[model samples]
Target chain A: MSLYRPPRTQSSEITPREVYLSRRSFMAGTAAGLAFAASGTALAAPLAATPSAYKVADKLTPKQDVTTYNNFYEFGVNKSDPAANSGDFKPTPWAIEVGGLVAKPQVIDLEKIMTEIPMEERVYRMRCVETWSMVIPWIGFPLSALLDRVEPLGSAKYVAFETVVRPAEMPGQSGFFQPLNWPYVEGLRLDEARHPLTILATGLYGETLPNQNGAPIRLVVPWKYGFKGVKSIVKITLTEKEPPTTWKNSGPSEYGFYANVNPAVDHPRWSQATERRIGEGDGLFGGRRVDTLPFNGYADEVAGLYAGMDLKKFY
Target chain B: MALPALPARLKPASVWALYALGLMPGLYAFYLGIYGGLGADPVREFEHLLGTWALRFLCAGLVITPIRDLLSVNLIAYRRALGLIAFYYVLAHFTVYLTLDRGLILTSILGDILKRPYIMLGMVGLLILIPLALTSNRWSIRRLGSRWNSLHKLAYPLLLAALLHYVLSLKSITLEPAIYIAVVTVLLGYRLVRPKLMERRRARRVTATR
Candidate 1:
C-alpha cells in the first residue's frame, strides 16, 4: 500500500443520518438524466451527494456561524457582508465553462454535472489566513472527477478557477471601488487539483449551499487557506502555466499562490501558529483558541505533495 | 484662509456633551457584541471597532493642532479629552483581544507580541499613549513646564505606530485602510512644510508692521 492513505468510501461519523440513507437511491438515479443541454437555466432542484469516507475527529462547527460568517468578497468585504448582501445573487441556472487544453471542453450545467458525478459528504477543517477555523461537513465530490470529465491535455499543468462576475446581482462587484478585482480567480497545480482531499463543494449540512457560502459550486482544498477555495466558480481553465490568483495579485508579499497552512510560515503581519475556532465555546468568558497544525492537520495525506519544497517559501 | 472670529472658548458643558457623543461607537459596539447583534463573529467585530475608534480619536486629537495653526481654531481645550478617550478605547481593544480573541492564553499572547510586527507595533503605540494619558492633567503641565510639550510630542510616534498597526493587521490593504493611511500621511506631511509657511507668515507680518 502507498504510504499516503487514499480516501476510502466508508462511514465517518460526520455524515448526517438522512443523507446516508439516501446514498443508494441517489446512485441508482444517476442514470436518470444527462441533460447537458439544460445549461443556462436559473432553476436548481434539490441535490443529493453520497457520504464520503473522509472526515475529521473534530465536531462540526455550528451551521449558523458557518453560514453567517464568510469571506466571499464578491458579495462584500466584511465577514457578515456576504450573508447580508448575497440576497440578490442567483446561484441557479448556473453553468461552468470548462476549456483550455482539454479534449472535451463544454459548458457543464450544474444539474448535468450533479447527475454525472457522485457527490460525497466530507468533513474537513477549513483554516482561514486570518487565523480563524471551522470544522464543516461539506457535500461535494473530488475535483478530479470534474477534471476527468474534461480530459485535460498532457500539456495542462495548472487548473485556474474563476468565480462568476454578475455585477448586477453581486453588489460588491457592481460598486466602483471593488475590494477585489472582478471575477476573483484562483489556481492549483494539476496534481493538487487531482488530489482526493481537494473537492468542489456544492452544499453543506445536507442542504443546498447558501449564496453567501458559494452556492452551486466552490473549490475546497483542505490543506490550503480558505481563500484558495474560490467560490461560485463559473470558469475552469486547464493551463500550461501557473495562473495568477486574486490575493497574490492584490498583495504579493502577504498572500502567495500556494497559501498552504503552515504554522511556521508567518504572514508578514500576523502569526499563524494559532487560530480561534468558531462555535467551539459559548464565546462568553473567552474564545476557543487552538494551535494551528501544518497542512491544517491533513499533513499525512498531502504533505508528500510538497515533499522537498520549503513551505515558508511557498507560503 | 480668511475666517470669522470664533468664540474665545467653548463652554465646559459643550465639551462634556461632545465627550458623551464621541464615545457612542465604541460603547455601542460593546453593547452589540454581548447581545449577539454584531453577527456570528462578534468577538472580532468588537475588537476591530475599538481599535478603529482608538485610531480615529487619536487622529481627531492630532487635527486640533493643525486646525489651530492653519484655521485659527483654538479647539485645543477638547484635545485632552480626545486623547484620553483614545487611550480608553485602546485599553478596551487590548482587553477584548486578550479575553475573546486570545482566550487569555499567555503563551499565545506572548508569541503574538514577539513574532507579529502588527501586534508589536500596536503594543508600542499603547505603551506610548499610556504616559501621555497619565500626564494629560493640568498638574503635569504646571510641574513639567516646557518638558510637558516634549513629553506630549510622543503623540507623533504613537500616531505612526497606530496607523502601521491598523494597516498591518489587514490581509490586504483595502480602500478603507488606504484612506486612513492617506489621511495620516497628509497630517504628518503638513508638519514638514509648516516651518516654511510659518517663516513666510513672519516675513509678511514684519513688512506689514514696517
Candidate 2:
C-alpha cells in the first residue's frame, strides 16, 4: 500500500535533524511493525493508497517523561490535573466494544488489541485548542483499518466516538463548569475518518500508554485540536448525520461542529497560527517556535476535501 | 499617654499563621511544576496559577474592611501583611509571565501588553500593588505619618484594577470575578460611608447631653 503523501508547499524545507530522527524511529519501530505484519489479520482492510511522511523524531522523551506528563481533563482545568488526580482511576481489566454499522462488531480486550495491530511510529505535531503544542511519537495504526472492519452503511456520513464514563474514576464529572460531557464525545466526517492522518493510537513515545494519557486506547486526529480526539474510548457509532460532538454542544460558536483544524481561523481568545512547542528544549534558553500549518500541515491531502467550503463560517 | 493602642488584641502571630496557610497553595503549585504537574503547558499553568493567587489575595485584602466593619473582627494587624502578599503574588505572576511565557523579551511583552486589554488590566493591577507593598511596613507608615493613610488608600484603586483584570481575562463575564467585584464594593463602601454615620450619632448624643 502506498503511504499517504501530502503535497508539501515547500518540499525543500526538511531539516537534517528531521531526516535523522525519521530513519531512527522507523528502524526502532520495526519490531512492532513486524509483529503486525505477522498477525495474519486481513479484517476488512481498505485501500490506503496515499503514502505518508509521518516519521518520529529522535529526541522523543522517555517513558518517564511521557507517562508523568499528561493533559487529562478528568481532574480539572489544569493540564497537570490528570497526573495529580489520576491516582484515583483504575484502568485495569479494560475492554473496548467496537460495535456500530460494521460487518464485524466485536468486543476486544486491550491485550489482544495492542498485540493484534501493527504499531507504526509517527511524529505528529499535536496542537491543543488552548494554543500550546508538542511533537509526539505515537505508535498506532490507521483508524481506517479498524473502521473498515465495522463496514459502515452507505448512509453513514459521520462517525461518533465516546469515552468510558465512570464518575468514580473521573472526578471532573462532578464539576459544574465542565466544557465537555463527563464521558466526552467527538466526531468526524466520514471522509475525515478515512483521512490518512487519523489513527487509533495505543501508545506514545514508544511505550504503552499511561492511564493519564488515555491508557487502553484513544484516537489521534492530528489536524483537529487535541479535544477532538476522544480518549479512553469505549464506543463508536456511525450515523447518517453529523454526530453530536461535545465541544460543539457546549459552545457551538466557539467550537464548530466540524472542528477541522485551520490556522487561518483564530480561536476566540487566541490565535491558532502559531503555538508554543512544549518540551522542545530548556525552559529558559531558546524555546522553540513552530508555525502551525493548516490541517496541522496535512493540507496537501485534506485540503482538497474542503476546497469550496468557507472555513471562516465553519470555524 | 495613648497606651500603645493595646495592639488591637489580635496577635501578629495569628496573622503569620494565616499567611503560612495561604502559601500552601502556591507551594503546591511549585511542587506540581517540579513533578511535571504543569504537564505539556507549564507556562500557561504558571501564568494562570500566579494570576489567580494575585487576584485571590487582592480580593482577600479588600475583604479586610468589610469583615472588620460588619463583623467587627478588627483584622487590622493582618491587613498590611495580606496586602503585601497580594503584591508579592502579583509580582511573581508578572515575573513568570514575562520570563517564561514572553521570554522577558521587552519587545514582545510590551506588544502583548499593548495589544491585549486583559494584559493591560493585569499590568495595571500589578503596578498598583507595588506601591502598596513598598509602603506596607511600619517604617513607611511612621515616616509618611498622616500621609501614610492617604497613600495606602490606593488599595481601593488596586482592588478595582485587579477586578478589571479578572473580568477581562475571561472570554465571558464569569460569576466568580463578578462576585469578587461585588464583595470588594461592599467592603470599600463600608469604609467610605460608615465614619459619617458614627460622627452624626456622636453629635446627636452631645446635643442631648447639653
Which digits, one per residue and each the tens of the lDDT, describe model 2 over residues B1-210?
A: 222343545576677877887766777887777666655556667677877887777777777676664565766777776777777777777887777776766875676677666678777777776777888887998999999889878877777777777766654433456577777787677778878967887899999999
Which lDDT tens digits does candidate 1 get at residues B1-210?
645544656567767877898888987887776666776667887898999999999999989978988888777778998999999999999998888888777987898899888899999999999999999999999999999999998998999999999988887766789889998998888878889989999999999999
Query: If you superpose only chain B onto the true chain B, what TM-score does each candidate give?
Result: 0.94, 0.84
DockQ by candidate, in order = 0.39, 0.20
Model 1 CAPRI quality: acceptable
Residue A38, candidate 2: C-alpha displacement in angstroms: 34
Q: Candidate 2, A154: how far from true, in Å?
A: 1.9
**Tens-place lDDT digits, model 1, residues A94-125:** 99999998999999999778877887878899
Deviation (Å) of A298 in candidate 2: 2.9
Local distance difference test values of all predictions, in order: 0.84, 0.69
What does DockQ come to for candidate 1? 0.39
Off by over 4 Å in 1: A1-46, B1-10
